[model samples]
Target: MNTIAEHIADFLKEYPPFDNLTFQELSDIATNIRVINLEKHAVLFQINDLLHDSFYVVASGVINLTTIADAEETIINKCHEGDIFGLRPFFAKNNYMMTAKAREESIIYAIPIAVFRPFVANNSDVLNFLLENFAINSRHAKDNVNSNGKLISDTAFYVDQQSEMQYIQSLAYNNSPLTTESNSIIKDVAILMTESMVDNIVICEKNNPIGIVTNADLSSKIATGRYPITETIDKIMSSPVVTVIENVSLAEAQLLMLKNNVTHLCVTKDGTSKSAVKGIISEHDLIVAQASNPGVLIKEIKRSQLPKDLKQIRDRLSDLIQNSIQKNIPISHISNIASEINLAIIKRAVELSILDLGSPPARFAWLSIGSQGRKEQLLLTDQDSILIFEDVAPEKYREVKDYFLRLAKRTTSILEKVGYEYCPNGHMGSNMLWCKSLTDWTKQYNSWMNTPGENSNDLSSIFFDYEIVFGEPKIEEVIENVIFKNAVNNTLFFDFLGNDALKRNSPLSFFKKFIVEEEGPHKTKFDIKTRALMPLIDAARLLILNANIKGIKNTYLRFKQLAITDSKNAEIYLSCAEAFLTLSKFRTVEGLKNDDSGQYINLREMSKTDKEKLKNALTPMKDLEELIKSKFQLTQFS
Candidate 1:
C-alpha cells in the first residue's frame, strides 16, 4: 500500500501548479497535507468566514462554490476531481466571499498556504498557472452571478482560453534594433548584418528609419553585380520602410507583413516614417509568437508536397477545432483561423497539380464557392468551385479548354485525397458546365439575371459568392464587375431570391417547438442548415446584393456592412449577425461530437439550456424574414 503522502503527491502531480513541481517537491508539500472527509451537504467554508490557513484540492466527489444573492443561493461553479478551491488566502487577506460545500460525500486535501507560498513566489510558471486559473474562475463567477444558470459568455471563454495566445496582445519585440546610416558602405552594412546574426538592417537618418536593406537586397544588388560593394547602403536599401506603432498586435503585424510583401516592419513611436524607431518585428518574431498548433499546421500545409501529407495536416485541423470549441473560443475566430489553413491547403494542392500537369495554357482563377468561399466551413464538406480562364481565340478554345479540364481533374483528385469530398451535384470546376472562359462566364451570369426562375436563382446564389483561391486576379475582377453592373438593378432576380429565402418558413412550428424532419434518414431531427442558418444567409445575400455592396462574402460580415449602409434596419441586422454566430457555433459543436455535418440535430437529446439558446437564436429570424419581405416586396411579387 502507498503511504498517505505518496498517494497525495501522485494525485497532486496530475494538476497544475503542483504538476509543475518535482515529485520530491510534491512529496515535501504532501507530507504536511491534511485529508478531510465530509458527507453530502457538509459546508467546508461559508460566506464571510475568516481566511483559512490552507487552500484546497478536491480529491474525490464534488464541491459547490456558491454565493447568496437576492435572498437565494446561487452556485458559481462546481469543483470536481483535481479542481482547486478556497484559494482566497493566497491572494487576499479578506474573509471568503463565497461558500464551499460538499455536493456529495467528498474527500479533500488542504495544503497549508504557508507551504505553497514558496512555490508561488519562486516559480514563474506556477505563479502564472494559478493566476490564470484564479482569474478565469473569478470571471466565471461574476458572469454566473447574472447568468441565472446560463453558460458563460463566448467573450469570457475566449479570454480564458486564448489568454495565453497573446494574438491580440501588444507584441513583445526587440527594443534595441540594429540600425545603420545611409552613408555606410554596402559591404560594411552587410558585415554588420552578418555579425549580428540578423537578416535585415534599418537605415536611419536622425534616428528615424528611412529605408531597410535585407539579405535579399544584398544578394540581388551586390552579389549579382547590379551595384558595387562599395556603393552607399542607400543605393541598395528599400526606401519608405513599412512602419507600425508599438502597440500593434501579432495578427495586425502579420497582416501588414503579408500586405506589404516584406519580411520586416519598422516599429516606430507614432506609426510613421517620421517617428523614431523603437524596434523591428520580423516574420520570425510573428512565427515565434504563434509557435502553437495553428502556426505549425499552416507551415506544414505550405511545405507539404504530397496529398497524404496534406491529409494529415487536415486531420490535425479537426483537433484544433475541437480544442478551440472546448476553450470557448468564439466560432467566428475559430472559423477564420481554420478557413485560412484550409485555403492554404487548397492553394498548395493547386500548386502540386501544376507540377504534374505543367503550366496552364491560359491565365485562370480558381474560385471557391459556397461555405468555403464564405469562410465559414468548420466541418469537412464537399468542395463547390468554378474555374474561370481568360478568353482565348475561338480556334484555340478546344485545346485550352482541354488543358484546364485536365488540370481541374488533377487538382480535385488531390483535394479528394486530402479529405474534401467531391460535390455530388457536379458543381466543381472539373465539370465543364461550371468551368468556362471569363467572357463565357459573363454571358452566363447575364443569362441567369435576365431569366429569373428557381434554377437560375439557385445557380446565381452559389456563383455570386465566389472568392478566388488562386491564379489571375484580373479574371475574377472582370466577372465581379459584370456581376455588380448587371445585378445592381435586377429587380426580377431579387424577387426570385427573396422568394427562395423564405422557402423554409421558420425553424419553429406554430407552437414554437423546433420543426424536425418527420421521415427519411434524419427522422425527427432538426435541420438547422435549412431553417436557422439558410434564412439568415439568404437574407444577407439578397439585401447586400440589392445595396450593391462589393467584396463582402461572409454572411455575418454582409450583415455587419448592411448595418452601416442600411441604418434604418441596423438593429435587426446586428441581431441577425449574433444569431448566426450562435447557431453556427451550436452546429459546429454538434458536428464535432458526431464526426459529420452538423446540419441535422437530434433535438430530443438537447439540454434545456441549449434548447433555450437555440430558440432565442431563432427569434431573430422572424424579424429578419419580415425585413426581407418588406424590402423585397415579396407579397406583391408572389
Candidate 2:
C-alpha cells in the first residue's frame, strides 16, 4: 500500500496536474483509483463517446494521440508513465475527435474528474499548466489522433512565432554611423577617417548629422586643397546627411545604401536630422556580419553598438563553438577562443558596472574561475569568477568592498542577459564572499589547502581552478604564488582532488556498449560532461597538479604542457587530449542541432558510421583512465 502511494506521489511530483496535491490528497486519490491493464492495439476510447467520470493516465507503455495528415498517420504526442490525457477535450465540451489507442502494453489510472475540477478552480499552478497544454494541443490538429480525428502538421502554431532570443536584430532606417563633427577641422576629419580605417563619414552639427564626407570628399577637395586642413568641416563637408527612422527593414537600408551610392548611413530617432543621431550602420558592417559563421560573426561582435547588439554577437558564439566542435577543432583551442570572447564581454560588462557606479573608488581585478580559468570552456557553461582588489586601509575596507560588490552584481546581470544562464546556486563573483581583496583570496586558498576539512571537496572544486580574467593581472599572480606555496606537495590536497576527479567514471560498462541513462528531463541518454568530458578533464587536472604544474586551467593545454615536460608519459597525455577534443566535437554538433548545452547525447540518434567513430574515440579515453588508475594506484582506492 505504501509502495503504491509512493509511486503515485513520485508520478505526481514529476508532472503538472498532480504536482500541487498534498501527500494525503494523493494517497486518498490513489486508494480510490481503478487501475486497468490493456494489451497492444487495445482501444482506450472511441469517437463521440460521452465524457467519462474520470481522466485516464498511462502508468506505463505508449498511448499515442495520432491524426491522419497528407494521407499518413501522424502521432502528435506520445504519452507514457504518469502522462494524463482525455481531460482537456472533454472538460471543454468538445466531442472526442479521435480515438486513443494503446500503442504498447499499458497500465492506466482513472481519477474522477469531479475531484480534479474543484482543485483546478482553486489552484493557479494547475490551471496554468492545463491551459498551456490546452492551447498547444487544441490549436494543433495533431491532437486529433489522440481524441478528435484531425491533421495537425499544417497548423502547428509555434513553427513560426519566434519569441525573443539572443540573436534576431531588426534593421531600421538611419544615418550613416561614421561621422565628422561640423566644428572639427577637415584635416582632423581626414585623420579620423584614417584612424577609424573607414572610407566615409557623415558630417553632422548639433548631434544631428547634416551630410556625408567620404574618400571622394578628400580626393576631390582636400588633396587638391580646395579646403585647407585647417578649414572647418562645414567648408568642404556635404550638408544634411541622409537619415531614416528605427523601423526600417533590411531591404530598405540596402536600397538606400545603393541609391545614394553611400557606404555608410546614420540612424536617427526621426527620419530627418531634426532629431539626434541614434546609430550608424555601414555597408561593410552589414555584409560581414553573416549572423552564421565564426569569421564573420566575430566582426559583428567587434562592431556591435549595444548590449542588444552584443546579444546577437553572443548568440553566434555558440554557433562558433558548435562548428569548431563539428570540424574536430581542438577543444583546447576552442576553449581558449571562447574564453577570450567571454573575457572581452565580461570586461565590457565590468566597465559598464564601473560607469553605473559613477566610478570605482580604487583599482580591482576580476578573476575567472573554474572552466573559464582553465580556458577549456567549449560551451557557455557556469560562470565562476571572483573579485580581487589592491589592499586599502582598514577604515576604507568597508567602503571599497561595497563598491566592488555593486560592480560584480552589474557585470553578472549583463552576462545573464547575454545568455550564459545564471548559475543555479549563485557560484558567481556577484556573491559578496567571492568579491574580495587580494589578501582575502590568498587566505581563502590557504584555508582550503592547509586546513582541508570535511567540506574541502566543494571548496577545492572551485578555488583549484582559479585564474584571472579582467582587471589587474599582477594581483592575481600574487594570489597564485601564495596558493602554490601552501598547495604543492600537499598529499591531502592531491588525494582530495584525485578522489573528485575519479568520481566521474568512464562512459563504458561491463557490456562494452556505452552506458546510457534510464530517465529526468533528458532520460535514456549519456551525459557527455560526466562520462567523456569529466574523465579527461579530471585526469588532466589531477596529473598536472600532481606534477606541481600551475597557471594552465584548460584540460588539453594542461595535458599538452605536461606532455612536453614529462616525456615519459607524454604519449598517454597527448592521447587524452585528442580524446577530449574528439568527444567535444561530437557533443558540439549534437548541441547545434538541438540548441542545448551539448551535454547529454541520444545513443539512438547516432548513425552506425558515427557510432563506430564514437567507439574509436572512446578507446583512447578508456585507456587513459586505466593508465591513471594504474599510475596513481587508484585501483585500491576504487
lDDT of each: 0.80, 0.66
Superposed on all Cα atoms, the candidates' RMSDs to the truth, in angstroms, are 24.4, 28.1
Candidate 1 lDDT, 1-638, residue by residue in tens = 24989999998888776878899989989899999998999999888899889888888988887777677887767777877778666544458777889999999999997787777656767765654454342334543342221212111122133322233334567788899899999989888889998888899999999999999999988899999999899999998899988876554565456445678999999999998999999888876765444556667787899999999988877876776676565677677777877898999988898889899999999999989889989998889889999999999999999988888888899999988999988889899988889888898888777777735634647777878999999988898888889887788888888887888657998899988898999999999998899888888888888999889999999999999999999999999999999999989988988988899888889999999999999998888877888887889533
TM-score top scorer: 1
Ten consecutive residues with minimal summed lDDT in candidate 1?
148-157
Query: Once model 2 is optimally superposed onto the true structure by TM-score, how far is the C-alpha of residue 627 displaced, in angstroms?
Result: 4.0
lDDT of 2: 0.66
The most accurate candidate by lDDT is 1
lDDT digits (tens) for residues 89-157 of candidate 2? 322234554457898999888877665655664566665455434333232334343342111211122
